[model samples]
Target: MSTIVALSTPPGSGALSVVRLSGTNALKILKRLTSTLDFTPRTATLTKLHHPDSNDLIDEVIVTFFEAPHSLTGEDVVEISCHGSPSVVRQVIDASRNLGATLAGPGEFSLRALSNGKMNLAQAEAIRDLIAARTETAAKQAARQATGELSKRLAEFKTRLLDVIVVLESAVEFVEDDLPPTQTNQIKEWLLFVLSGVGALAESYQSGHLLRDGIQVAITGKPNVGKSSLFNSLMERDRAIVTAVPGTTRDTLSETIDVGGIPVVLTDTAGLRQTTDDVESLGIERAYRALNEADVVLLVVDGSVNADWHEAGLNSFDHKTQVVVNKIDLVQYGHSDLPQGILVSAKTGEGLDDLRAAILGAFRGSAIQADGLLVTNARHHEHLQQAKIEIKEALVALDEHRSEEMILAPLHNALRYLGEITGETTTEAILSQIFATFCIGK
Candidate 1:
């Protein structure tokens, strides 16, 4: 592969910027640009970088060298830390490029790392996730996967599966009648155990993905139902305008907040009702759109007013909808006809904790266990589904007392699908798709 170079840090001026180079020729290019010095392995050396051909001074930079098989990509690599000035970073990169280092495509460094066996595909994807993580919990989850926590768990599952395959293959080699009853039961037990593990891991994807990518929640109700106030309460900031007049919020406003370790994008939508104003109608249309698109809906109602539940659009409820009765302070002495939903006072912040808990509880629901490994990537979920299907097929074959050949095919397929998760049986196309989501220079 050709030598690659790219800015490792965010573009634009800052205190410092990193330009990374990796490949067999990485060290040679670094040597060509810097003054002659002992470029010891795994050491950061302060040096002056010059243009290879022009010999023009580019910048005073710190050069760190990682020798082959010990570096990020398991190949020789060099990182040039220069002043974050755009021109300085560009010159440094152009200098390397002029010296035969090609500009790296997005995620080439991590791709090389996977290609060289330095990290598995799960870890590589985790690197991307970690970079894109929005909340502290998301970052921690991604960091865990990046450090091979998911890989380790998947590896254990794969080992058990391979064990099952070995037993079944042995049975296939021998006649079915010759196989012991105890061994057959053991095979069934192992198959069930492996299936349970895979199913659990697959099930974790919902929470993992929600935590990583977050959920969109639309706050919708009739005019003057305190939807905007609840939005502000959830955000802990006055982001949306609140007024006594109905249809005050003419458009949808959104802000993201961390609720019980899950990122929630709370959208304050215009009141859901028939309107004559064109602008309000447009906003109402958008509100319905947001309502339809949201992962969860916060159906707000006025606790102080005796309004029909149907009139407020809260008659029907779904699993994704949570009813919030706001203005509890005004209704402390009286009870509204609609007795359902969580009661709260968006004015005094009463019941806010319960509201937050309700939002988190509705979506989270023990989908992710504390300190447990989760498979967040869609690709991994798909592969695990495939493996589960194959395991079920093998189990069916076993139950039917079919020939060993019938069971072997599904067992081998199960192994193949499992191997794809750890990148032992992945194709180049899938790898490309996964890595392409990464930023250049990793």
Candidate 2:
């Protein structure tokens, strides 16, 4: 691959911006930028960047060099930390391009690292997850995966799988007669061990998805029922406008908050009610859509007033909906009069904790792993499922007195599926899709 260049830091005005390049020509481009030859590996040098042809001074900067095989991409890497002025950064990058460094595409840096054996596919994806993590707990989880924890675990599975494969193949090729019952029983035990481990890992994907992507929650209620007020209270800030007037919120409002290390994407939709106005009607349409898609729905109702529960759509709400009775402060009395639900005063901040707890309880099966690993990517989960299926097939073939070829066929497929998770058997098209989600310059 040719030398690739891009702005490593977020673009625009800042104290400093970093421009990174990786390829065989990275050294040449750095030399052209600074006109200094002696760039010791892993050392930072203060330098002045100048235009290549015109020799016009561009900017004073700090340059760091990471020599080949020791860098992020396992190539000669150069990083220029210059003044954050857009003009200066532009000139520096333009000068490098003139010297033969083309711009990098999304995830090109880490993709190269994976190609050069610096990291496996799982570790490379982990780096991307780390960059995009939403919460501290999510970041810690990604950090652990980035350190090859998943790859290490997968490696152990592969080793044990290979052992089973070798024994099965030997019975197919060396032993002409049918295997004795003793050896067959022992193979079953080893197969069971691998099956149990893979099955457990596959089951952890639900927890991993929640930890990584979080859950979507929709807040829906009739207008003036304190839905917006409860949205602000839940967010701990006034993100949406609150007023006594009806139809103030004619559009869906959404925000994310950290709830016990879980990122909750809370969508505050327009009040669900009949309206003649076209705009409010559209908003109500969106409210229903939000409710349909949400992992959890908060059906807020005015506690101070009484109405038919069936009219509010609360009576027919699905199991995922939580009935929240807001405005208990207005009631200002015992819960005997209020309908059966979680009573809270958006004004007094009552029952909000229980609401949050209820939101978490919706996903009781996918609790966060305190200090364990999970298959965060859906691709990984699919591969594990496929491998599990094939493993089960292999066990069935062994049990049913099937041919050695039949038993080895599914076993080989199982190995390939496992290999795909770590990129040993992954294809080019799938790799493109995986790396395409990343931002340029890694």
Candidate 3:
């Protein structure tokens, strides 16, 4: 392949920027631009870069070289660290292009690494996930996957499945001879072990996806019930418009906050109440929609007032809903028939800890153990589910004493589905789809 070049750092001015090149003539292109003839591989050299034709000084830059079969792409690579000025970055790119290097497409570098067998498809996807990770937990999970945690588990699964297939094939082939037959019960047991392993991996997608894409939490209640105040208190900033006037928030305001290492998008929707005004009606409509789509709902209510179930529509509450009674500072005394909820005052920051804990509990359900394998990708989840179905079908066929030919089909399919997870059996279309989501420089 021809050499490829791209800015490996984020756009705009900073202390410095990185421009990377990888392919067959990466070093050759670098040689044409700089005066230095010899560069020690894997060492950073401060050198002067000049235009190839004019020999005009481009910029004083630091260049690093990586030889083929040892670099990120498993090919010769060159990286230029230059001043952060956009003009300097542009000039360097144009010079490299003139020297026969093409601009890299999105994720081309990582794709090349994958194509060269430096990393599997799952590890490549994990790199993208790590770059896009929004929380510390998500980053850690992605980092672990990138370093081959999922690959190791899948490799073990393949090994055990292959063993089972080999023994079954031997049984089918040697039935006419005096060779000892493998018991059907033993085969069933082996298949069950593989099934249970895949099932556990597939089930992990729940928390995996939740951590990858954060949950939406909507605060819903009638006017003047401290929805905006609670939203501000949770965020530690006056994000929403708070005032004594009813219906001050004529629209929904949303912000993302870290709740115990899990990202929670807290949305303060307009108060739910009767309003004839056009704008307020529209706001209320949006609030209802937000509540309907929320993964978790914080139903804020006034602790000083009696239950207004008739107007608030408490009967429609689902399991994802949690009651939070605000303004407990004013209603610290006994309550006659108030709605049951976690009491707190957004004003004095009372019971806010409980509210945060409740939010985390509502979404996570139970804590995921540190450094465990998590299947976060939706495509991976689908493939795993398909594999599970095929394995179970194979198990059924074995129980019925069906012919070996009948069982092999599902077994093969199960193997194929598992292979797709690590890209051993993935199609070009799926590969393109997976890598297309990555940024250009990756």
Q: Each candidate's TM vs. the true structure?
A: 0.89, 0.96, 0.91
- Residue 202 lDDT in model 2? 95
| TM-score of structure candidate 1 | 0.89
- Return the lDDT, model 3, position 2: 85
In candidate 2, which residue pairs clash? none
- For the record, the alpha-carbon RMSD of candidate 1 to the native fold, in angstroms, is 2.9
**Model 2: per-residue lDDT, tens digit, 49-123?**
999999999999999999999999999999999999998888888889999999999998999999999999999
Instruction: State each model's CA lDDT, in order.
Output: 0.86, 0.88, 0.88
Candidate 1 clash pair list: none
**If ranked by TM-score, best first, what sequence of candidates would result?**
2, 3, 1
Per residue, candidate 3 scores C-alpha lDDT tens digits across 329-422 of 7885685456788888999999999998888777555454334788989988998999999999998988777777678889889999999988
Off by over 4 Å in 3: 175-185, 274-285, 306-310, 313-319, 335-337, 363-371
Which residue runs of candidate 1 sit more than 4 Å off their true CA positions?
A: 53-56, 167-177, 241-250, 273-278, 304-309, 312-319, 330-339, 364-368
Over 4 Å off, model 2:
314-317, 367-370
Per candidate, the number of residue pairs that clash is 0, 0, 0
TM-score of candidate 2 against the unseen true structure: 0.96
Model 3 poorest 10 in a row by lDDT:
363-372
Q: Which lDDT tens digits does candidate 1 get at residues 1-442?
A: 9999999999989999999999999988888998765699988899998988888898998889999999999989999899999999988888888889999998999989989999998898898899888788888999999999988887887888788778767766676355578877888998899899999999988778877878888999999999999898888889999999999999999888987677888999999898789999999999988988887888998888778655756444466888888988888465546558989888899999998888777755656443577777888899999999999999999898887788879988988998898798999998888778889889
